[model samples]
Target chain A: MARMKFLCDAERCIECNSCVTACKNEHEVPWGVNRRRVVTLNDGVPGEKSISVACMHCTDAPCAAVCPVDCFYTTDDGIVLHDKDLCIGCGYCFYACPFGAPQYPQQSAFGVRGKMDKCTFCAGGPLADNSNKEYEKYGRNRIAEGKLPLCAEMCSTKALLAGDGDMIADIYRQRVLKRGGRPQTWGWESAYGASG
Target chain B: MKTLVSTMAGLTLLFLGGCYESPNVTTYEPGVYKGPKDPLMMGKADQRAETLKKRFELVQMDR
Candidate 1:
């Protein structure tokens, strides 16, 4: 099986923020931490484009490289996840991540930094599949349940595609061909590198 | 009075001595994943992929 990936067709996205809402609701993500969000390049401007953004789960993930505690790991399906127990909340991953995927739950001066949180591709953490502990820490294990990420599944415009990288690439290629133009897929090269 | 002042000075010096910051340098080994093994990887890869493919066809294909 090829690596799992996400593709956001910018031409089709309508900036509805439904993907963001679905992810937050699915994961019961804590306040101030968003697993997914819609980014608009030019708000209220003519010909503005919006795309849903989250952890792209990069091929050579910078987050894993810079982690002081060595908490981050990539799965066989290319999903990047981290051990919250080992995370020191030092925010190195935040700086290292090009997508700005890492998030902290709080902002306090008492030196009490919360654990780092990011999108898990709905695969949950290292814990047992669909277990309570895994869900509590890393959200639902939709991948284990034979389902794709909710953000892509629930996209109102079908703009967000998530699954096998090659499969989604084919889908996007077909869309572009049918439309008779090459529409930009946001963040594809950045997240997966130039090869994909 | 002399002895009391000396004691306070010594205590302050001790506290200062203990306040030195530890170095934050880390030797990063590239491509090494130090986190726990994901349970998903333990399952059959072909079966999981087939299931996901069916799901994609059911819900995510060319909609």
Candidate 2:
């Protein structure tokens, strides 16, 4: 099994929001909902770090645990996804998720929360691969086409990485070795825990 | 005597009924996924991983 995961290199990230733009463009994600965003720590400081934030698609997802409707499912590649039709817009997953990955769209004038949406790792949802219906509901099915997420692919600085866990970790390890420094893989420990 | 016997039988039934168990309800299991299966899982995962490995080597390894 691949165990697909996302890793953001804080040292490499320049907070350009290219990943964010790439995600929005690729998915046509709604106005209020951002599937991916860059968060910068210690703003205005010279040594500040920025990292791209989204669902880590954890080995053991907290959102899945807290969902009342049990709509969440993990793909064979370890991508965390939920059926929008099954989601009740309860916002439990939002609270449970450590990375704040679960997002609800406010489509109506009343500001009523829509179904929960989160990062799917570009694997799409529980629908036919590359179908129009699936695209309408869950955006692109790039994983089915053997492609990684566009957010990572379009990243100019290669700060955001999406792929198999072990492979990406090896890549990061190599980067660290070359750079000769200990750099944090931000949110990995909380999302995936120590063993992951 | 008949009244006493009826009371005893009723008590015994009540006691046995207290011990009767009902069928377990089938709710969603914790940590188990209850949603529809994804399309990506339908293909050969090993082949997919291999393809991804090649991609990583191409784009990520040298960077």
DockQ measured for candidate 1: 0.44
- Residues A116-137, candidate 2, lDDT per residue (tens digit)? 8878888889989989988988
Per-model TM-score versus the true fold: 0.82, 0.83
| Alpha-carbon RMSD to native, per candidate | 8.1, 7.0
Candidate whose lDDT is highest? 1
A27-143 in candidate 1: lDDT tens per residue?
A: 999998988888998789988889889999998889988887889888777888898988889999999988888999885877566999999999999899999999999999999
In terms of DockQ, the best-performing candidate is 1
> Whole-model Cα lDDT per candidate?
0.88, 0.85
Off by over 4 Å in 2: A184-196, B1-31
Q: Which segments of model 1 are wrong by more than 4 Å?
A: A107-112, A184-196, B1-31
